[model samples]
Target: MSRLDDIIELIQTTNEVYFITAPGRVRTAYILVDDIIELSLKVFLQEKVYEQRVNCQIDLESASLVTSRNHKDSLRRYFEEKLNIDELSNELGRGTTGVPILQNHLVSFPLIRHWSANDPNARHTFDRVIDDVKPFFALPTTAPVGTPPNPATNLLDEALIRHKTRNKFYHDQNLSGLDINDEKCLSALCAMFDLVDHLFPTFSDEVKSKHTVRCQIGVLRLKQTASLGHRELSQPYEAALQLLKKGHKYDFERRSVEHSLVHTVSDRFFGSLREQFKNTIAKLQVRINKIDTMARPKQDHIDEKNDKEKLIQILQKQLDQINALLGAP
Candidate 1:
């Protein structure tokens, strides 16, 4: 199963399963999510660092890629092979903001907590960092963001609040903060999912709506293949989808509260995570296809055959890694 499916199975949302009761499922989800964000950033940066460390010409500015240290011999004692961005990520100076760090171990000599003292906008807060990456998502560009940006007007403000709450839960056994009961936990969990939606790329509302038409077209093809095509059977969904693309979404309501729940976990339920994973798989597949195309040329010599074999091995390794993540055979 995917990591998301594992989370769904492990986090019990129900109040009771037998004579006993289970609580704090959403609270656990909160903790896992907090760490996952940090881990994802580290992995993402590691790849970028590996790809650029030789020339030290990464597109993004990061202290971890301090190319100035290339000639420093003493430091080479510790980093004899190559600079490992992943190792530098654990340096005490870096916090969990998940934004690229401005002062790494070599750059600072001695760590400084207030690295953003020079510029306030560059402050390392979850609130601020999410804003930078949100554009990479399908979210409305105008969605408000700040360092603990106004909750009254900003949806992201609560993400910071949840982090504070998580800190309280994590650091204190006495549990002094607001208790993470069902209502509070569910609300916090939904907000965390909103944070996740901002972190990853997938079809936005309009994109997803356009996708709906494509999906219907796929179904229509299937029907045509089976000699069961009918125009009326397909018209209704496609028409609604076209209107949806214009921001005219329609959904039948079972109850009033259900309207508010439409965008919440109750409605979308891990959809963002699944979509992000699907996007990752699509990207890996694209890379694999390109590598295969490179290997498909005529092998006119022993050297060409050796190069082709190496490429195939590299492709197989990537596929194996992806399959392991997917729990595939």
Candidate 2:
């Protein structure tokens, strides 16, 4: 299974354990949920770092960091060698080789900071990431007026609180006095859903159906939309419209959804319509040519000319419609 699927399975197992009638399981559930969130974030951060490295033309294999085992080293080499950001690289470089970084480094807040500093694509991806979490941290004005205030201001706040609670449980080794409870465990599970949704929106359906715990968190509904195919199509359509408005040349190398939609629409719908129009226009032109070649009565020639002129007008109107759909001014 993929790493994402593994994390999702862990999340599902945690939810099952949280709801089962068992003593001393609430703390375990919380830790499990927190671990899933951290793991999901680590996977997401590694992907972003790798993508940026590839964009910068850094050779992952040549740097001896092609495999997932050496992704942290790859990230360090990329930032230090490619971008020349020695400070960030050195900061990320402190951990021993092959050892996982701390929770803070893998989570959204710190990873987003590093990405935003170095990559332009980070802002767009971060905006989407923030959107996934907004429902969790929504305010009355920002959300519906009757809704409850968002519990945390941002993802960092949520991560910090959960991490602190987890550390207390692990380091202190005393759950009796700790504040971990069913409600807190549920909140952490919800946060895990948000993080996973941000990283892999397409997996939302699988996560929702497989998770056993039922919660009243508002973010669940938002995650459901990610599974919608029509919603996915709208993204490409809107992008295509924006590109059309800007009058920019299409980048064939990118092969974006917009690019595919343009070609699909042209070939399947507009291309066929254009061919039909061309046939009609060609037929009219042939009749006009024949009328000119043959010695017909002046009145007969005038009537044929008028008929050809009417067909030309009709053809022009159809052509205009086609051009309008093609985004011609």
Candidate-wise lDDT, in order: 0.37, 0.50
Listed per candidate, the RMSD to the true structure in angstroms reads 21.5, 21.7
lDDT per residue (tens digit) for residues 178-294 in model 1: 455544544543443344334333312322333222222222222232233233223322332333334324344222222222222221312222233344445555655555577
Q: What is the TM-score of each predicted model, taking all chains together?
A: 0.29, 0.37
lDDT tens digits, residue span 74-104, model 2: 5555454452333333444543432333332
Q: Which candidate comes out best when scored by TM-score?
A: 2
Candidate 2 segments whose C-alpha is farther than 4 A from its true place: 21-25, 58-153, 173-176, 205-329
lDDT accuracy of residue 110 in candidate 1? 21
TM-score of 1: 0.29
Give the TM-score comparing model 2 with the true structure, all chains together. 0.37
